[model samples]
Target: MNRLVQQMSSTPNRRRRPDPAAGEGSGAARGSNCKNITIMKLPRYGALSTRRDDVAMTTIRVHGWPVSTWTRTAAMTCIEKGAEYELVALDRFSPEHYALHPFGRMPVVEVGGLVLTETPAIACHLDECLGGPALQPEDLPTRTAMRRWMSICADYVFHDVVRAIPRGRPASAEELAVARTALERVESLVGDGPFLAGDGLTLADLFLAPQIANAREKAPEVLDGLGAIAAWAAGIEARESFRRTAYDPASV
Candidate 1:
């Protein structure tokens, strides 16, 4: 038997209770909190379906906390690509998390039988495989720019600036200064169009949108003087994909 198949076959069946605070229309059953929700069952490897000659149906499974920004980034990308996925919530510090991600990170994606860790890689893989509106720009120069901004968000904005705010830690003066500089840079990156990489929404937008929202919630001042960035953020936030996968602490 294949490794993934053997693993799934031997896994014990379990039930999950929906979070009560998960709001209506958010897909959480209203009364499910008091009931047992069966864990989603995946077909065995041998039983996987093929629609045409050699094309098998795509199955995406996301493992992470619903409220995690990285998790939400992967979820939003899945949504944008029109791919349906199963979200398997896991405790970040648990052995199970360490098993999937050596660094004990959230939002690992399992597609078919292949596992992909890290949000940017997962998002790009889904975009390529699923064949939707391309998330990355087609032009090489624009694509490079998009990748650059994505790196900035992951390295600087997310870690140095937005990290403390979500953890309930106050931003130190130095952190705030760094964040302000990053925001100004981001503001400058915004062109005449709404998205970060010119007119079209790219992987960079998906990567930064959650972080920007978090900043808005925890440190609105980081976005204070950036009119263009605020407008860009508003546009991204209004997207259906972002709305569906947006983080809400109350819902967690």
Candidate 2:
């Protein structure tokens, strides 16, 4: 929803479609960080929980719309680390965000004084710096394999699953055609182990989960027939990290 949400935010107000204000970004500061203090009265979409009663316990601040794939990916990374994040709902297309991210991607994360835009980098830093079960494998070969799958999730799975999704509708035939090879490759890989990398979950699974969920929501039949991905995603969907980051469909 990164580019699509930005496009809708830029559309003419006269259009019959609901305006981006439903995302409640209009009055948001054009270029400012959430001052270090916690401001939990969110003006836009509902907050993704960081599971702490005293929200200030975390320095993790995720500036993004809840429904955006990368945004949720960042949040999931923090959750899996057992670290809390303060979600600062901001307009993805704002010039300030473009300055921070250059590419203008959703969810510019500020944590421990570092700002990250790309999902993979954000996930890796959180996984390493924050404490929790290790998402990266210990063995050198498997770790390398884990990195390989993470790259595939970014370059290939992203195009087929998340980018292929059409707003307010399911994926079209052409989009599904583009998605076929990647989905099948995932199916073949899942048969090798319980995850994309190997026996246990890794950053590979965290990176792919939201994108796969996007495909399942928009083009479920493609996944249904590829029993392996369906089964694999089902396992991921059941995780506490995934559930904690999931946005309400109505917000989309």
Candidate 3:
């Protein structure tokens, strides 16, 4: 989820500084090239099936922590798209994950026995597969707004959540300030809605929900102070889709 925000903020519209992890390229280069390089452009299932006649609806195995925002983001997408998948919980300190992903990242989606890394890629594929509620907005401005907020949630909220976790650590003053700013922006966008993209619930809502959940669980006070973002998050929690993908604390 932090990666998601970093990537989104690095895009053209946001015009923010390039994340070191995203590289030092210009926005255009970073956006297009980054997608091409980091993302493996697998052919759609139908395309593969038509060409080789061997494609089938194989189970998807998601490698991630149940409570992780990224994991829930991917899970919510799968559930929303009506796809069936299995979750393979991963340990951050595990040597076994070295071969699976060089960085040992979570929410790596394996479909039809082939692995696909990166949450953005997985989300895009799920949106393509599902298409009905259209997780991404079709209108240009709405699309841009949706992507922008998604990036903000990833960047500010999720990043703070990550930085706050430790044996003797809590969110710093700076981190709380950032969280407040993020909540402000979220309130501006959410504005008395049952979902992030207004009346229709979309991937944007799911993507942000888990991050908020993590914050609520670990630092309820922080979440409580931000009334609007808290309310928005509660609405998402009330949804059936979210409940199904709800994190299991004991297992995570």
Candidate lDDT (C-alpha), each? 0.65, 0.65, 0.59
lDDT per residue (tens digit) for residues 25-144 in model 2: 221111121221222233332443333232335477898988777788888878887888889988667887776667777777776545655665566556655667777666544554
The candidate that achieves the highest TM-score relative to the unseen native structure: 1
For residue 10, model 2's alpha carbon misses the true position, in angstroms, by: 51
lDDT of 3 by residue, 96-201 (tens): 6765677878778766434566665566555554323567655434444455556666666566554454323576677666665665555555555555653566
Cα deviation of 213, candidate 2, in Å: 0.5
Q: After superposing candidate 3 on the true structure, give the runs of residues whose Cα lies further than 4 Å from its correct spot.
A: 1-56, 93-95, 165-185, 250-252
lDDT of 1 by residue, 38-63 (tens): 11223453442222221126667899
All candidates: TM-score: 0.74, 0.74, 0.72
Overall local distance difference test of candidate 1: 0.65
Model 2 residue 28 CA deviation (Å) reads 34
Q: Which stretches of candidate 1 lie over 4 Å from their true place?
A: 1-56, 169-174
